[model samples]
Target chain A: MKKNYSNEDLHSEQGATISGQQQKAIVCNGLTKQFGSFRAVDNISFDVNEGEIFGFLGANGAGKTTAMRILCGLSYPTSGEATVAGFDVYKQQERIKKNIGYMSQKFSLYDNLTLLENIEFYGGVYGVSRSEIKIRSSDLISTLGLQKEAHKLVSELPLGWKQKLAFSVAIFHRPKIVFLDEPTGGVDPVTRRQFWDMIYEAAANGITVFVTTHYMDEAEYCNRISVMVDGRVEALDTPANLKKQYKTNSMNDVFYELARGAKRADN
Target chain B: MNSVEVINIVKTYGEVKAVKNVSFEVAKGELFGLIGPDGAGKTSLFRVLTTLLLADSGTATVEGFDVVKDYREIRNRVGYMPGRFSLYQDLTVEENLSFFATVFGTTIRENYDLIKDIYEQIAPFNSRRAGKLSGGMKQKLALCCALIHKPDVLFLDEPTTGVDVVSRREFWEMLNKLKKQGITIVVSTPYMDEASLCDRIALIQDGTVMSINSPDRIVKNFPKTLFAAKANNIYKLLQDLRRNSEMESCYAFGEYIHFTVKADDADIVRISQIAERENHDGLEVKQVIPGIEDCFIRLTLDSGQKIMDRKK
Candidate 1:
C-alpha cells in the first residue's frame, strides 16, 4: 500500500463513505465496567472506523482509562459487546493483544537498552523474524534521523527524541491498531508538532490510531473525538461539528462546557 | 524585597549541562513561572533554589536567606513540592497532611486558613490511602500538604503536568487564590498556555533561558507577523508552505498551519495566493496574533541557530 495519501484524501473518504459499510476497527455496545458498586465505565457505546484517528478525551476520573483498558483487552468489561480487530475483547483477548500496540507516557521504552537493542527486543517480543527486525530497525532509525545516535543508550536521548522513538517502536510490528495515552506530555511545541506529523503518517498508512491527550490542540487533529464525562460519553463527533454544536470557536471551550458540570470529584 | 533570587546557576551531570548560567528573581507575593518542557533544567533549578540539590556554581536565595549559608531558615520559610508525588503513599490523606505539618514544626490548625480552600476539596478522602486517590485528588492533597505550614514562598514543579484540561484550569484557579493570600509562588510547567496565568514567566529550554517577561510582553515581542492558514488537506498545505522560499517557518497549530514569511510586509492576500498556487481546497488564511507558545518556538529556534553558528 502506498503511504502517499494526502489529508484531503483522508477527509474526503471519511465524508463520502457510509460509515455502516466501512470496516469497524472497534465496536463497543453497552460496555460497562463495575468495580464493586462504582461504575467506572457506564454502558458506553461507540464504533471506531478502521484506519481512523480516534481521540478519547476525558477529565481525571472520568473513566477514559478504564474504558480504554477494556477495549485494549487488558481488563474484561462487566457487560458489553465489543470487538477489536474483528476479535471479541472478552474471549479473544490474546488475539486482540497480538493485533494491537499500546504506549503510555509513563511506560514506553527501556532506559537501560540502546536504541537498536530496544527495537530488537520489542520486535522479538512481538514475534517478528530476526532478519526482518534487522531491516526494519535500520529503516526506522534512519527515518527518524537517529543513525548517529542509534547506538547510544535510550536514557541519553532527549525526552522528545525518546517519545518519537518510543512511538516508532510501538507500531514496529505493523499492528492493526495503536493505543497512545498522553504520548506527547511534557514535549515542547515544536516536537509536539513533529509527533503529530508522525501520527498522520501512521494513519495514512492505514494503521488505526486511538489516542488520548489533555492538549486541546491535539484533540482537534483527530478524525473523530469522544469526550467522556462521569463515565458516560457525553459528546462524540468531529472537532468542527462539536465546535459548531456547542456554539464555540475552539475545542477547548467545547470540552470545558461539557466537563464543567461533571459531578465526579475530578479525582 | 524579592522572595527568591538566583545568580549564575550552573548544574551538570557528567557531559550534560543541566542548567547553564541561569538567573531569575521572583518578587514577593508574585506568581512567577519557569516555563519549559521536561529536561529543560526547570527541575534542576527548582532543586537548587529549594536547597535539595546544590548547584555546581553560583548562589541562590529563598525568602531572603541564602540557600547555602542559611539552608535551614530557607527550608523553614519555603514549601517545595517536587514534580513527583513525594508524600507517603501508604499513609492516609489526613496522616500525610499531619505528618507534613508536624515535620515543619507546625500544626494544621495554625495554618488552617492558608490551606482551607484546597484541603476542603480532598477532605472527603481524608481516610483514604494517598495511593488510592485519583490523579486530581492526589494533586490537591499534595498542594494542601505543601501549604499546611503556611510558608512564605511556594515552589511547585509541574503541578499540572499530565492533568486533564479541566483539572489543570482548576489548579490554576487555586494558585490564583493562593496568590491573593500574599504567598510568593514559583512554579514550573511544560505547558505554554499556563504561562499567561503567571504574572511573569521565564521561558527555558535545553539548560538555558530563552526569554523572561510578562506573558503579554513576550507575545507582543514576537519578531515575525504570524498567519494561520487552513485547508481541507492541512498536511499538504503544510508541505506546500514549507517549500515556499518566502516562508520562514510552517508548523501545524490545531486545525490550522501557523506560518511566518521571510518578507517583512507579508499579508493575508499573499498567504492565500501562495496556498492557491498549491491548488489547495477550501483554503483560508488570516493574520493572527501570536501567543506565548509562538514566542517560545521562535526563541528556541533562534537560540538553536545561534548555537549552530557558534559551532561553525
Candidate 2:
C-alpha cells in the first residue's frame, strides 16, 4: 500500500538489478520447480511491482504455469526463495494465498449459480462479511452493466459476459495481486477488448496484475512482460523494448524467434 | 477442379440454425480459412462437408463426390481434426498414429512423407501416452494423424484455439508447406490474426458468410476512416468517444481504442477537444489500418442493422 519506488525504479529493477527495498508485490530469486528429471521452471528470477501489469508469456510446454503455481502457493517450488506480498512462498503460503487472487484459463465459478450468487459465494470464500457482500455485488453488477442479467445463471450468458463476470468475482475481495491466465481465449475481438478494459481498471486501482496470454496484441497492453522458453526467462522487458531487442516489428514475431530455437519438447 | 464445394448448405439442430444456407468452394491445392468467433457455424459446415453429418438442405462435395451419395468416398479422401482433441489419450503417440493409418488401410511408412515435418516433432516421445503430451505436442500429433492417410483435402476446426502463439505460428507454416504439396486445406480458427496466413479466408458469423476474400481485400474493403486514439484515462476515453455524435463505432484495441469518425481530419480535432473537455491528458490519435477482425466486426454490425431494418 505504500510506495517506495517510482515506475522508473521498478523498470530498472526488472533488468537483473534488485534494490532490496521489499517494495515489490512479487520477488522471485532462483525459483525452480522440477518434475521427475525435468525442470519445468528452471532457476527463474523476476520482480513484479505493485499495481503493474506483468505479462508472463511462453509456449504451451514452457514453465510459466509452474512458476505461477509456486507464486500462488498452489505448488511447492523444488528450490529457491520467493516472496509474494512480502510473505515467503515456502513458509507463509497461507498468507500468500490470502493476499492473492487467481483466475485460471477455465472459469472457477459455478456455472449453475446466478450472477449475484456467484459474486456472493466468492466474496464469502474470501471472508467478506455478508453485509459488505450485498453492497459489493450490487456495485459489481452495475459496473459491468449486468443489471438485467444479475439473476440469470452463468451458463445462460454469452462466453464474453461469463468471462467478465468470472473476472469481477475473482477480484471481489480486492486482493493486492491478481493472476489471470488466458482470460480471453475464445472470445471475439470486441469482447476481448472489453475484458482488457476490465484489466486496465483493475490495474489502475493498484492491483498488481500478472497475466499470461497468447494474443500478441494483448501482450502489448501490459506495462512489462517476461517471456519464457524451455523453462527459462528468455526475455523480460516492455513490449517495445522486446520488439527492439529481437529486431522484429511485432510481439508475435518476437515470440516465434525465442520459441523456435528451443530444442526441448515433451518433457 | 474444386477440391471441395458447398452449395446453399443449411443445417439445424432443434430450434438453432447452426449453418444457414452457407456456400463456398475451395480450389484444389488452396489453403482456405474459416474465421469467426464461437458458435459461428464453422464446425457445422465442416461436419456437413466432411460427410460426418447430414445437411438439412443444399449440397456439398469433396473431390467431385456428393456428400450424401458418396459419403464413403468423401470420407476416404478427406482428413478431419475436430475442435476437441479426439486422439486416444491412453494410447501412446505411436499407437495413435498407427491406428489412424491402419484405419485408412495404410501404414505409417506408406504416408510417412506427407506428415514427416509434423510427425518428427512428436516422434521422440512415441512411447509416451498421448495424455502426457503438452498442448502443442498434442496438436502436432493430431495433425500428423490426420495427414497420415495423405488425404486430398484436410479439414481442421479451431486447431489452434488454446495453443500458444509459437505453436500457432508453426502450425501455419506447416499448413503452408502442405499447401505447396497440393493438398487442399480448410482450417478454422477463432484467432483473427491467423486469418492472414491463409490464401483466402471466409469470415462467418451466426452461420452466415459475411465476407469471402483474401485477407488484404477484406481489410481494404473496410469503408470507414479508422483511427487509433488514446488518452491517460482509457476507459473514460472510450465512454466519451462512444457518446460523441460524430464518432462511429469505437472499441478498445490493445492499449488504444480503434474508432471511426463521420468525416475526415475534422473528427480528429473534435475528438481531441472532447478528450480535453473530459480532463484526459496526453491525448493522441493516429490513422490506422483495419485488420480482418475489424472488417468482420463492421460487416456483421452492418448485417445486423439491415436485418433490423427489414423487420421494421
Q: What is the lDDT of residue B159 in candidate 1?
A: 96
| lDDT (tens digit, per residue) of candidate 1 on B1-312 | 899999999999999999999999999999999999889999999898888899999999897899889999988888888999898999999999999999999998999998988888889889999998888889999999989888999999999998877888999999999999999999999988899999999999999999999999999899888999888877778777887888787888888888888889877887778778888889888999998988887887776532111111
DockQ of each: 0.41, 0.30
Model 1 clash pairs? Answer: none
- Tens-digit per-residue lDDT, B16-117, candidate 2: 888999999999999999998887899999888888899999999899999999999988899999999999999999999999999999999998998988
**Under CAPRI classification, how is model 2 graded?**
acceptable
Weakest lDDT window of 10 consecutive positions for candidate 2 chain B: B303-312
lDDT of 1 by residue, A1-267 (tens): 324334633443343343324488888899999999999899999999888999999887899989999888899999989888777778878767777889989899999999999999998887777777888899898888888888999998888889999999999978778999999999988788888888888888889999999999999889899999999999999999999999988898999999988877444
What is candidate 2's TM-score for chain B alone?
0.94
Off by over 4 Å in 1: A1-21, A265-267, B305-312
**Angstrom error at residue B217, model 1:** 0.7
Best by DockQ: 1
